[model samples]
Target: MQGWRSSMEDVHCTLLKLDDKAWSQWSYFSIFDGHNGLDTARKCAEDFHRYLLKSFNEMLKHGEPIDGPLKSSQLDLILFRKTIKQTYFFMDEQLRKSKTQHDESGAVVITCLIGPEVIYFMNVGDARAILVSKTGQVLLSTHDHKTSDPDEQHRIAEKGGSIWDNRVEGQLAMTRVLGDFSMDKDLVPPDADIKEYTIHDTNNPLGFIVLACDGIWDVMSNKECAKFIVERMSRTQDLCKICDEVLEECLKRGSADNMTIYIIKFL
Candidate 1:
């Protein structure tokens, strides 16, 4: 899913799978919440998977053992964190080499890497990643990266950055993303800085993931959505439809920004 209001700004969502070499296993799902502009979002969406694969292979070459006893879920999280770190370095170096500065473009990422026995999930920034249990309970939910997080403020200051405050006195926005090069200068130890999360054994009889940008979440509660999907599934089990319904509801609630959602059901 790639949704944009203007040609320059974009929001992207993606899904892919890594089939086990033995042809017996695989993993899938992804999303990119593009901000400032869609160009970065599009570039990241197109290159994220490839970059991660390359980064993983590089890790293997660097003597990071791939053959380990840890479940693939855990290993994937480690690899993902490593990949994000590598990508950050690669971007930083590329920008520096090109003398690029003052580019206010970036993206947030959320993903569910379905492994052999668990779902390794990760969220960076504002998008939501929810896990529903078989008994109709929310097992987990990703929180927004607002001014509430201290690390965000510290990084912003470390980068010698400042945010706009329309309220005359209050200004708040979390510090993290894909392309905001101005703030990139502050993220020392880049690899260790990217946000990551993991969930184990998510093979419930009726468990799934619903990921969407703030456009939808701004109006609907997590439980409101879970209930909508759970109750509606009795007649039709279309995740995309659920996503569309959420978008419509957001519009009804006066959201003017571009909206995109990706829903995944695990049974």
Candidate 2:
């Protein structure tokens, strides 16, 4: 639950909490990276949470008649991705008309749901999600979204945008995201792009999640952060304290963009 910004731009928003509702038992955590302005970032963060809840409710409505054949994993990913895409489209269209964001406007979103024995993750863009295990192992991490990937580069080129030095010139750092209406319209007939990821239990490991913006990740490696967290947890095992240390470490390492982290420990 810490946020550090570099210079004046690069906005980030985060939320961490334990949930005990009638629908499920889990802890929810999320990070939002707003590119154009903090106004959109703040609103995106608030709206995403609501969108998730609505998605779950919709699943319940559609799943009630399934009897014992209901599969949470299959349903969750499908519903979550659908909900996120719909939500992003709604906001992108509204922001284009409501705000002064003449430039492309959007945000990268990463989320984690820690359930009793598994973790569900979804991400769009470079913002990351990391998991640490009790045995001091780095279990799960997401790849960044950028032009380096051939698929990403192709998408950018198709949209009449160029990727330089791993950035979307004046738009973003990745090929996919939640908004960026101006850029979307220029590149396509309707000018919109939305993406999502669904990580099943097959590849997950036994570590806490290290969710942060590129500011921190840009300067560090997946293995390096994994070792750092493992070493810290071996001593204190207090997640909040570990978060503080990770933030400072990133600053000391000279991260120039905004640095924000959402650490989720499965206890």
Candidate 3:
């Protein structure tokens, strides 16, 4: 839970202990990186968690069990995925209808929900999340949505958009994001890549989950970040100090963009 901003355009939220009575065991964390301004990022930090909780509650009302058991059926898993997707859309729609004008600004978002038996994540734009094993292996990581990606390029072209200088319409660098009303809605949709992982060996432990904006990723590889944490944890158990060291490392590596990193250790 440490962040360093080269500018004031980055925002983050952390719920080390979420207070939802229905899902008391869950915790939430997220990072929002604003491109043109900080309005969208600030708004997301303030409201996105509420939207996610609301979506989860709606699914619970429909008989989707999300608590008290470690085992989840296939149907329950599907319903959870749907709830996350709907929450992303719901947040974006709210941003669109906001009283503040955000035609030129937008944000990249990465959010994670940690439950007793599973960890769920949703990512949009270039921000990323990674799961590292105890042995310093990268088990999973989210992909960045950039114009240079073939799938993103194809989608943009299909929506009557062009990429030049590796930017959408030669302006925005990311292919997917929230807000940015100036970009074509179809080209820059608010769709997020949702994923979940079951925590199987809680006794032996899984490792760590690292959520960060592109600023850190641009300078450090996934393995490097994980190894850094592992080395620090071996000596001291100060997670906050480890995160601060990571931020300093990024700055030493000359990361010019606003930087944020959130680490969740499973051990």
Best by TM-score: 3
Pairs in clash, predicted candidate 1: 10-38, 85-191
Between candidates 2 and 3, the one scoring higher on TM-score is 3
Worst 10 residues of 3 by lDDT: 66-75
Please give, for residues 1-267, the per-residue lDDT of candidate 1 as tens digits: 223356424445444445243112435456666666565566656766566656655655654455533345434456556675676557545434443355566666665565555565666556677777655567778766655566665655566655445110142243445555545345422232333334444464546777777667777788887876777666678777767777777787877767777777766
Name the candidate, 1 or 3, with the larger lDDT value. 3
Off by over 4 Å in 1: 1-4, 11-15, 19-24, 62-80, 88-103, 154-172, 187-206
Q: What are the runs in model 3 whose C-alpha is more than 4 Å off? A: 1-6, 64-75, 202-204
Residue 196's lDDT in candidate 3: 80
Quantify all predictions' global Cα lDDT against the true fold: 0.58, 0.62, 0.83
- The TM-scores of all predictions, comma-separated, are 0.75, 0.77, 0.91
Q: Write the per-residue lDDT of candidate 3 for residues 139-255, one digit (tens) a residue.
A: 889989988799999988888999999889888889889888887878888899987877886543588899999989999999899899999989988889998999889889988
